[model samples]
Target: MPEYSEKVMEHFKSPKNVGEIAGADGVGEVGNPVCGDMMKFTIKVKDDRLEDVKFLTFGCGAAIAVSSMVAEMAKGMTLDEAMKLTNKDVAKALDGLPGNKMHCSNLGADALHKAIEDYRQKQAS
Candidate 1:
């Protein structure tokens, strides 16, 4: 197993925003079959900002920590701001992820971006 940073372990042990948002404005789901990791992010928006963010992730400690960190970062961010969020940022927020588990950060960012996309699509309709 790869060594994890203290922040990663802390988030994995007690992830914030761990559940789904009821009647969420947007939801995104992604999976990496090669790594058997799955993630779903749900969000609520208000005035073009992410009013709330939550996630349910099934994967290793790194993936869970990534999801938790993503949720913490995206909440209250403007849609444009959240859209710019990147895997690099997530990994940095967690201090860093081992090279092999870095993909977890990618998944987290993708999931949040997709959720924002979903919300935008709804608005456009």
Candidate 2:
């Protein structure tokens, strides 16, 4: 049986940053067709700082937990700092995830990085 951390369960039940930003500075979508996990993250940045982060995910419980945690971690961070976010950090934030769910952690980090990259592209254009 997979034992889920209490923190992960809590975050999933009452997810943070669950909505969408009307005019997001960046938006990123990623999915693993093999596992059928999909997540879309949107960020609003101001003064190079991550003002807000939101996500919509279609996956298992682990995916929801990871997405919620990522949103909470990204807010108030600078774009560079947010970019540095890793799957390990997210797993730690959740008090640790099951070994089988490790990919969910990676998915969250990838989505956030993609969103940051989108923001950078917008700035460049």
Candidate 3:
């Protein structure tokens, strides 16, 4: 296995926003069967902004670390700002992820985006 960055290890050992938001404005769940890595992201919106964000993840250390990082990145941002977040941004926030585990970590951002989309769809209908 590849060695992880110090930041990655730090987040993995003590992930933040590591649970669901009760009555979340939006919730998204995603998984990679091949890697057996799964993630769920929940969000609360206020005035078109992400007032809060949280996540639950199962898999490797990288997955947990990325989930934490994504939540930190999304919180307190406008929906448009949060939507601009990308996998690369997630990885960079974690100080970078192991090459072999990049794909697993990438799911964090995808899950968050999905939750935001879910929230938007609900608002439209």
Candidate 4:
């Protein structure tokens, strides 16, 4: 049993913001090949706020759903607020994910944080 809800299946089947950004301020890619899950997240930030987010994920239904939800949640949020987003937040936004799929949410949060960090580093330079 995949433990996926209808919403999760819907998102997975038709993910939103499923592409790369042109001139993205930051891009982060993470994956566990052993698990066959990979996600690439691109972000554009302006005035310390997330102007946009997009993702391309190669994984299971849970991974796609998490990635889509992460992108939707991160956009229009300040960097500080986006950084505060945790796996729990993503899971909660999706109405809770399966225990085994928890790592998918973790991947989304980690990639978003990494992208934000990358943006900060570029701005510092």
List pairs with backbone clashes in candidate 1: none
Mind giving the per-residue lDDT tens digits that candidate 3 earns over 38-118?
A: 999999999999999999888888888999999988999999998899999888878888888899767998899999999
Cand. 4 Cα-lDDT: 0.92
Best-fitting candidate, scored by TM-score: 1
TM-score of 1: 0.97
In order, the Cα lDDT scores of the candidates are 0.95, 0.92, 0.90, 0.92
Q: Give the range of the ten consecutive residues with the poorest summed lDDT in model 1.
A: 29-38
In model 3, pairs of residues that clash are none
- Candidate with maximal lDDT: 1
Model 2 lDDT per residue over 10-121, tens place: 9988988998899999999999657879999999999999999999999888999999999999999998999999999999999999998899999998999999999899
User: What clash count goes with each model?
Assistant: 0, 0, 0, 0
The positional error of residue 8 in candidate 1, measured at the CA in angstroms, is 0.4
The residue-level lDDT of candidate 3 at 10 comes to 92
RMSD values for the candidates in order, in angstroms, are 0.9, 1.1, 1.1, 1.0
lDDT of 4 by residue, 22-56 (tens): 99999988997787899999999989899999998
Per-residue error for 119 in candidate 3, Å, reads 0.3
Clashing pairs in 4: none
Q: For residue 69, what is the lDDT in candidate 3? A: 91
Worst 10 residues of 2 by lDDT: 28-37
